[model samples]
Target chain A: MFWSVTQSLLGGLLTTFQIFLFTLLFALPLGLILAFGSMTRFKPLRCLVQVLVWIIRGTPLMLQLIIIFYGPGLWLGHNIWSGNEAGRITATVVAFSINYACYFSVIFRGGIEGVPAGQREAGQVLGMTKSQIFFKVTLLQMVKRVVPPMSNEIITLVKDTSLARIIAAYELTFAGYSFMKSNGLTWPLFYTGVFYLLFVGILTLLFNHIERRLDYFR
Target chain B: MAILEVNDISKNFGSTTVLHKVSFSLEEGSALAIIGSSGSGKTTLLRCLNFLERPDNGSIVVRGETLFDASMPFKEQEKGLRTKRLHFGMVFQSFNLFPQYTALENVTLAEGLLAKEREDYKQNKKTICEQIEKHGRELLDQMGLADRMTHYPHQLSGGQQQRVAIARALALKPDILCFDEPTSALDPELTGEVLKVIRGLAEQRTTMIIVTHEMAFARDVSDKLIFMDDGVIVEQGDPKQVIDHPREERTRQFLTRYAQG
Candidate 1:
């Protein structure tokens, strides 16, 4: 029975890991684009992006997941995300990507702006085009500056993956909770913490390695 | 013909005028050193030539290419200004080297981009990379940073960083170079190292315009000198004549202050 529970929880952990990876894969680059939009010289676009980010960040991710999962079916009378495991996971990923992207964008904007204006001027005077300056000089320095904050958010995201259980996504937490409900067992539920701890522990090590590599900027 | 010409350039910030009808001409392979007190608009004049700061009214003609003309719509001038910026390299008071790039990468980054701008270079990636590496190394070697090329800006001393910045500027092979008090941010001991490099460039007769308070170096290295006070040129002539015998009272006062201080 214990072996079976372990096997079942591992299956759930796989789903959780999928959610975590997909969220980061979509959010990281989307956040950077939003960051540029937020700081763009074009007044209307900047304000529009800022407002959209404000709304996403102001609301709870759990609420966002519920709305995203059901809003299309309820409001439009069309079940875009059908009652299937893949559809549920897709909705969770979408809601999480949008939510985390807003937070990451704020960090990215701070990091980009934190680089001294003189550095851009230096690139310009050396005959670099604006895009070249942004990618070559500004972007790398911004990455170095943003890593610590970005790592913090990513760790929080790993734990937040449990929230996907609200949409019946069958992630690690849902698998653990099912055992308690069906078999009157609590230990397996507690075992879920181990999985999260291990995941976050490995992430911490990875981020530390990244920080060391970026240390040359300081 | 003059390598650079600034004709009646004027700038105003809000209501107060910062540069008033500033005019100057620089010959090829010559250095013009501008000296002045604080708020004298010397730096503004230098920045205007590179289009870093737009002059409200004037024309900047570099290598016979009209970079900025007040009559042209500001929007249309951006492309020309950017393309022409290749001909006017500038070194800032603070060594603004990209902190993430090593000295060698800092020197090569612009060269690689400028190369890629050409359609033929896009098809010859290996050849372009090799060419940029060779050119970058030569500039760093000239700046006496041969061994320091792999070091990041933060790892190097201020003097070394400034030298790397100079190499980064020179990698473009600009028609003229401009320095905005390049040694001002360095320690007294560090100042000599940067000034020595500038002196070397002067010996090679690189066309340059320097806004500086280093009266002694200005007299020693610059072919022409201009003393600016209160948004206008109070005096300008051969460096020795301007330094030794100032025609304007403002220039005399400024020189006396520098000499005593």
Candidate 2:
């Protein structure tokens, strides 16, 4: 039973890992750009971005995942993300990116804004251009400030990917539950906790190391 | 030509004017100490130099270049302001070092920015470490903060933080360095360490403008002094002439109230 559970869980683990990496690959950069949008000095752009963030953050992750994956087809009347493994993955990515992007945006906004206004002024006086000031002084500091909260979100994401099973994507947790349905083996369902525990443990260690490296900014 | 000139520069927040038709000029490489009571607009005048606060009237010319003009909007003058900012460095009372960055990162940021602007300016990225180490080391060494280079702002004392701020400002080798009440945040004992550092910079002939309340330090280090009151320069002259022997009654009264008791 344990052997069969391990095999099914491993397949689920593979799918889970891909979603996690792909989401971060797209989500991190998209979050930074959204952060800039929310921070834009132009009132219209800032207002528009803020409203979007309010919508995403104000809603539940479960509702968003269901709506984004299923809503597009119903609203567009095209069945765009059809029923298949690849299609499910695509929908999951879209939903996950939007939800995480909003969370990441708040973190990014706080980090960038938290950097003192004087540092940028000092940069300007030193003859650095606006872009230079951001990349050098502003962004460097923003990264350090954002890391703690960002790590929290990233670790949360490791668990959040399991939510993809809601749309029948066959992720780790789904694989564990499959054994109970097929052969009435509840142990396999409980064993899913191991996969989650290990992933979260690894992420905790990485974040701790990064915090140590930033000790200079204390 | 004066190295820097402020021609009738004024600024208002909403309807209340903080600076009004204020005009002044200073020579290259001179220490001009601006003294004033709270809300007297000393810092506002200094910020206008860097275009951090856009003036509502008139213009500021740096080294004979018209960086700001009320005739043009701030967006139109932004390029000139950008160019002008390259000519000076500002240190804040709060020691606004990028809190996430170490002292070394703060210093190299200036050099990196300049290198990026000059496109063909291929900097050997590998040597950047050595340069930061050398220059960052030297500036900190000069400010007596060599051991604290890797330390963060919150980790350092108020005086030490201000010293790092001064080091960060000088790292760019700017044509002018401005300080806004740099020692106000420090204790009296720590204040002297920062003042000593500034006096050393003055001795090195680094062009600077200091808005401060330390009357004795201002008198000792300033080559020229301007007393600002209610958004106007009420008095101006050599430190000895203006601070020691005031021509205006208000300046005299203000100095007597704050001067060493």
TM-scores of chain A in all candidate models: 0.98, 0.95
Q: What CAPRI grade goes to candidate 1?
A: medium
**Highest-DockQ candidate:** 1
Over the stretch B4-33, how does candidate 2's per-residue lDDT look in tens digits? 888999999898889988988888878989
Candidate 1 stretches with Cα past 4 Å from truth are: B122-127
Candidates in order have lDDT scores of 0.91, 0.85
The pairs that clash in candidate 2 are A127-B86
**TM-scores for every predicted model:** 0.96, 0.91
lDDT tens per residue, model 2, A100-180? 888899899999899877777776677767787788778867878898999999999998988998899989999998988
Instruction: Mark the regions of model 2 whose C-alpha exceeds 4 Å error after superposition.
Output: B73-75, B99-105, B123-141, B144-156
List the DockQ of the predictions in order: 0.74, 0.55
Residues A33-92 of candidate 1 have per-residue lDDT tens digits of: 999999999999999999999999999999999999999999999989979988998899
